[model samples]
Target: MASLNVGGLGGYLREQRRTAQLSLRQLADAAGVSNPYLSQIERGLRKPSAEILQQIAKALRISAETLYVQAGILDERDRGEVETRGVILADPTLDERQKQVLLQIYESFRKGNGYGADDGPAGEGGTSSAGTADAS
Candidate 1:
């Protein structure tokens, strides 16, 4: 768990929006921000206020805590909600197919464990292992 950096948050949000198949216009509409402003924020040319972050979170259908993490306002320990299973999936060693499979498994585990879409618990067995799953 590390303190989030504002630049990191901006990058993460942009990536998340892209991964969700959302255009800047679409995400801006959802977040209730102007498309140009959202684009600027995504490009690291602007920093969103906490209130704007909250609105963006609402539009993304994710917890504001996620935005906080992105905005560098909170560390992982301060995350009130929003499980970050994708962090694990984002390892460079993982190919796109592997990422997809892991994401699916993680989502299934979340569902089986009574986790909400936004504030789900992370882990297939409520635990983490440092060992590599692949030798390559």
Candidate 2:
């Protein structure tokens, strides 16, 4: 797992906020926090609690686990998979809604069957067992 300190966490939060296209004030409003507090968090001047992180993740429409990992509240279980998620989150082509949906589906598959890169729902050809593109 990456050793993410307050600075790293703050950077990660800033990146996510930018990716979501939300101003600090807007995110603070959505997360029920003060704008100054959110600013402090993003500037590495404050360490928010797990509850606050959860709230921020909700407001960002991202997985709370992702924030938890970045905040060092939880150790990353799978570095490769987590990196994949980071790529997905950081993809400039995909919109926030698309990214969120892809992340949700990926996480569900991981939790449901302990899937890895080699054991994805789709096979090597990138097609489902039903011989069609998997919409879900």
Q: Which candidate gets the maximum lDDT versus the true structure?
A: 2
Roughly what TM-score does model 2 have, to 2 decimal places? 0.55
Over 4 Å off in model 1, which ranges?
1-4, 80-136
Per-residue lDDT of candidate 2, residues 64-135 (tens digit): 778888888765654457677889999999999999999877766664543444343444333333332233
Give the Cα RMSD of candidate 2: 10.2
- What lDDT is obtained when candidate 1 is compared to the true structure? 0.69
Best by TM-score: 2
Error of 2 at 88 (Å): 22
Mind giving the per-residue lDDT tens digits that candidate 1 earns over 73-103?
A: 7655436323455465558998889877777
Q: TM-score of every model?
A: 0.53, 0.55
